[model samples]
Target: MGSTADNVTKGSCICGALRYEYTGDPAMTALCHCLSCRKIGAGSTTFTLAIPSPNFHFTSPSSSSSSSPGSTHKNFTVTHESGIRLKTHFCGECGTFVAKEGAGENEFPGLMIVNAGTVDGEGVFEKLAPPQAELWVKHRVGWEGERHGLMQCAGFPDGL
Candidate 1:
C-alpha cells in the first residue's frame, strides 16, 4: 500500500504537510540529552537517526520546500566555535524538528540527524539499531528508566 517513492520509508512532519524519503538504513543512532536537543523536543532527550545525506531527499521534485499543501520547511543554523555550522530543518506548520545538517564532522560527516519519531510508521524506530551512545548525560533531566548499555558521555563522543 506504499508508494514507490516510499523506497526505504516515508517520513514527514506531524502535520503531514512535509514528506521525504530516507533510503537504506541509518548509519548511526543515539539518544541525545544535550540542552539544544532537550529544547527542541521540549523534553529531556531526543532520539536521532544519522542518515547519509545522499540517501535523504524531499519527495517532491519542486525547487521549493513547501511542496506539501499545508506544510513548509524552515531552516535554522547554529555556528560552532570552530566555524562548523549546523542547520536544522523543521516543519513550519507544527514546528517539529525534522532534520539537522551542516558541518558536524566529528559524528556523522555528510549525514543528517533526523528525529526518529518523524519516520512514517509508529514503532519503526525500534527496528533500527539500538542507541550505542548517550550524549550529554550531564545535562540529562530525569531518570528515563532502563535502556540498552549505552556509552555515556558529557557531550558528543570524540569518535561518534
Candidate 2:
C-alpha cells in the first residue's frame, strides 16, 4: 500500500530553517479541517502525513542557516477544543510549521503529524500515499467542496 522505509523522504520549512527526513511509509494521510490545523496553516484545510516517531527525525541545519546548536525550531503547545493536547513545531526563523506532536491521550500518540506541503523534491507530494480520510468535515468551509468518496469524520477517528 505504500513505499518502504528505505525510500527516504526529505523536507524543510518555507525558509529551509527546519529540515527533516523520514523513512518508511506513513501510517496514514489525511486532509484536516479542524480549527487547530486551519489556524496553524492559515488555510481552509491542511494536508498531513502521520509517520511513526521513530521513522521521523529533524536533519541538521544547512550551512547557510544561522541557526545555532539546539535552536532548530520552536514549539507551541495547545489544547484542542476536543480536549487533546498538541505541541506544534515551527521553524524558528521563518515560522513555518513543520510538524505536531500529540499528548499520550491523543488518537495517534507517538505519531508525528508532518505538514505535507513542506516536503521537497519533484513529485514528492504525489509519491506519498493518497489521503485516506478527511477529519473534522463539519468545520470545512463552504467554498471547499467535499472530497467525495473519502472517509469523512466529524472528528478524529476513534482509536486511529
TM-scores of all predicted structures: 0.79, 0.86
Q: For residue 129, what is the lDDT in candidate 2?
A: 84
Judged by lDDT against the true structure, how good is candidate 2?
0.82
lDDT of 1 by residue, 1-160 (tens): 1222445766888888667787877777789887777767677889888788898887632327543555477767776433557777777778878888765555347788888878777567556667778887877766774355887877776644
Off by over 4 Å in 1: 1-7, 61-71, 79-84, 103-108, 145-148
Q: How close is candidate 2 to the true structure, as a TM-score?
A: 0.86
Cα displacement (angstroms), candidate 2, residue 66, comes to: 15
True-structure RMSD, every candidate = 4.1, 3.9
The count of residue-pair clashes in candidate 2 stands at: 1
Clashing residue pairs, candidate 2? 5-24
> Which candidate comes out best when scored by TM-score?
2
Best lDDT among the predictions, by candidate number: 2
Clashing pairs in 1: none
lDDT of 2 by residue, 1-160 (tens): 2222468888888888788888887888999999999999889999999989998888856423433545667777888879888888788878899888786565467799999988886676667788899999999999998889889999998756
